[model samples]
Target: MSVYSMKTGLSSILKAYSPTEREKAKNIAINKVRFEMPKLKGILDAVEAVNEHNNFQPLNEFVAYLREAELSDNDFLRLMSDAHKLINDLSPKFTNLVEALISLPWTKRQPPALQAYAEFYIDIMVAHNKYVQFGIPKLISLWIPADGDAALWPNGSPIEALKTELEAVHRLLDRILTAIPMSFEIVLEAIESKFPYFKKATHVIAGYIHSVLWLIEYKPIFTEFVVQLVLQKLVLLDVNAPRSEIEETDYDDEELEENENAEIFEMDDCPKVGNIFAFLISLTTTDDDVQPMKHPIAHTIDICMEKMFNFLNTKNPNLLNASAEQKLQLNKFWKILLSAFDNVILPSHNTHHVQFLLFYYCSFKNTIAEAFLTSLWDKIKNPNISAVIRQAAVGYIASFLARAKFVHLPVLKYYLKELCNWAHQYIQSCDQYRQNGSLKANIVFFSLCQAVFYVIAFRSRDLTVDRKSLLFLQSLQLSAIVTCNFNPLRVCLPPVATAFAGVTRAYQLAYCHAILERNARRKLATVYANDVATPEETLDTFFPFDPYLLKLSEKRITLHYLQYQASEAEEASVVAGHRSPRRQRKRGDSEMLDDVDDFIVADKRQRNIELARSQEREAQFTYGLSPGFHM
Candidate 1:
């Protein structure tokens, strides 16, 4: 009988039987299809041919056959062999047919069928490698409507249908990702042929890989592979942003206003640059307030983190003034990566993974460094550079130097010494620029002071004497300059100068403590005897040097002296009085007496107010005026 006639006869036999016999009858019917399966085009085509009427009777019987079928290793291998043969006979509707096969209830439930479908999906994609390489990306683009791309999707293309199709393919892709003993090397072939990076389809491929990584269970081996793909795309986007130009009409505001909810990423920026960030955000995801129990792909996260840090460290005068949209997107990308670093990568460390991060950042030298120590210091010390860039560069380098491991401590010391030199030169330059009335040098001067303080703070106990001494002298120099030109420092850079004072005081105290500890260690005098002035000397330099300081110091002394005299007078008066009510009292006693005194004062003030008001009213009446003009 033909497939349709077999279904009709099975229905007739099922209706003739009672419910109790119906199951056995159904099994008999399903066994017939299972017997015909060996001669069918493939399991997929066999299912379609048996279920052509959409009554799903043949499909239901096929599911029963799969459920009862043996799924041992050898049985699964035989099924895959059949799939391999069927894959060779695929037509243009291969994706549609694969979708149909996996759609059956038994595909996932029956291990044999699921395995067969997974293998078949992989085989088909592999068989038409060129079609997949081109087709998968085109399908991903259908997710977004742009550049008349809506018409590119078939006229009746349903989004849910497309999503389901992608999911089935991605599930097989997941098996390949997990290395589930597939018959072919899907990932390797795609990597070699498609070469997803540096292409328009980069983000689409990344999203597909992400879907696979996301849907599959966490496989320890697959984590790094997935992260490598993510990092590759991030590097691609970073490299592309500067070179890509926006068309004049790309950001036409009127066009944007009409479609407020659509992806504005395509308006001016490179298509799917934001998708790089999207993949990153999705890959490193974890619950809030919970540490990722697993470390991210360590090398990958580190390299990406360092890249972001370096990008943010430099001014990139071009990027700084890039189109507003570009700048915003870049900033958003950096912020997301930084957040991922904090919440994902950093906590993934069991202990001191930041040691590698420090090594990576500080490992650069000379012309090879992306943001080298010398160039960053130059940027920080350059008066003409934008303050924002200078400040960021100084902060980034100083933070790393402060945290440098013991292996790189010598390099850190060298860089700190250079910054100290820059501080000295800035002090001298502040003079000529003082005449030019330029505040830039003073800003740099104040920023360097903060950076020095951070270094000291980070390495409070570990700071070498040379580093401490240089910072000490520099702090003194900053104090001296500020005191000599007090008005300018405050008028031009109050906030920075004030911060400089606090930082200088902190450094002074840290240095002083360090000196005392050293002396105690050596069993010598606690007083500092080196060229670097003690904290006391730094304080003394500020005091008794400025005339304003002299005046303030004298006034403070006089105020204390007068306070003493007043207290003495009050005591004497109290001693002379016999607790008379007329005797004056101290201001407060935190007792009933204070409350009574306050009430009395308030009552007397009220009486005086009434008396004044009555006198004013009488005067106005006697002057024969209506409280406005004299008679």
Candidate 2:
């Protein structure tokens, strides 16, 4: 077949067949073009013919086809491996095709095509730097003092060598930066356009951004610029502004404003936009070397912090009142913000920045605590919200406490006390609670208790100093956990032989306390051994309401034994499976608790009667009006 005939045949088949069927059609077309039209090699003349024909309309459909099709291994390898036979190194046809692909409206293009161009761009990069390699020695050589080192070069003056090295680094970096021009832009657009469906693509773009920042030096002119870009991206600020308001005067234009207005931020954008935080962390990372290479900029950190604070300040109404789906999005943003706080923002070396953060945290500490706790309480109280959403809210509240663990201990303690008091009041108000009936209020109270326990545990882990206050706080924390995990069983004269359900929980809580106590006590013994005044004084106010807990030194050990026995029994039962229906019930054990209420009432009556009889015995004093002989 002639070249014209082959081209027409290929076009017809591509147009006629489905994307999945096009591979077979492509095979037939390739054979015809390869064998029959020997004058035109596979790639060179094909690209030239397409350009000469001015037929670019089919490229879009071709891109769509590539996206929809998954070629077999053999065909894919053949396509890749045989490409060298088709191209002439001297020809500019391949270059022109690449340029055309690059210059196309990438944001409008399909991902597969953009990805294909990305691979091509990488190939071009490899071709450009086929002999060059950037290493630590090269980077260190660039930084060497120009006038101090003569032997560093041996070929020329230090200045000349430095210049050459710097140029080489810049050249290599520039090539890398420009390799996939506007491809990331397209990816970002696609990410936004496709929303949650293209999350993997979002990660891919984020990974690409990370690689770029990692491979290149942020020194010289790019540090501040890149930092600002990354910070803005995190906050979803696409446009860059000047450092000063005066300098920023010319930033806003009609087109820019229009584009800004056109931009829409959806819930799906959270993870993609939030990726900037991870990138920021990477930027601030350092090695163990005496002179670390890079550090996060103070100003850049300020920008990100302000953005986050502003976001939190404005507040998401949905955080408090939202549907499950809306809550999911809000929670996702919260997770990202919390992660950034723990990983980057809280650990920042900027004193003023950290102070500004602490200032806000301290000022609004009560308000924040109130908001989050109230939201959580409301969720648990609400019957309309699904169990999953309510449970998620509980989890979110726990995470919020963790994130805000840096709040002053006294402030946190005050909030916790308030929460406990409120819960206590709620329980007291319920008639069912006084009657020894199961109370729904216990759920909210227990959830709050659990939150307190988690916060205290976190604080214990984070506090390692040997200060007197640390010891007090440590004891207070352990007491709080013990109290929170305490089960409410009325201790009567009969001493009901019941299994303490909270034994296992208490054991766990006590273990954490033991860890804190061990560390804190050691520190006190080592540092404050000579300080008699400190050792003699003890605060009773910080202790839990239950004195038995403090007296039991081997409580955790005993609980561990009981827990092991219970687990062993449970495992044996599981192995035994079902038992005979005629099995005997244990003594004092009610198979149906509700049915045993009559017995409980009778027991209570008996106790009351006994108390009255004792009073009557003591009432012999009532006959004192009579002569002493009458008694």
Task: Give the number of the best model, judged by TM-score.
Answer: 1
Could you estimate the TM-score for every candidate? 0.34, 0.27
List per-prediction Cα lDDT, in the order shown: 0.38, 0.34
Candidate 2 — what's its lDDT? 0.34
401-466, model 2: which lDDT tens digit per residue? 434423455655555555455545545565344533232334344444444443343333233223
Task: Provide the lowest-lDDT 10-residue window in model 1.
Answer: 539-548
TM-score of 2: 0.27
Tell me the tens digit of each residue's lDDT in model 1 across 1-631: 4567587765333335578798888777767765455324335655455446444444444444555555555555555665567666555544443443333332223455556656665666666553454334332332332323333232212256445545555555555444433422444444334333333332233333334334323333333344444444444443333211211113244533443333323322442564466446544543232221111122222223333334333423244457887666544443443343333332231122222322343333222132345556777767687765565556556544543332255565667667766766665765666644333534455555556644543343344245655454454444443443312322211112222322334334322212222323332222345644232111000000001011111221111110101111122223222233432222111112211111112223444344434333222222110100000
Q: How much RMSD separates candidate 2 from the native structure?
A: 26.6
The regions of model 2 sitting more than 4 angstroms off are: 1-189, 192-206, 209-405, 432-442, 453-631
Q: Which ranges of candidate 1 are over 4 A from the true structure? A: 1-82, 100-119, 130-389, 404-412, 423-446, 456-631
lDDT of 1: 0.38
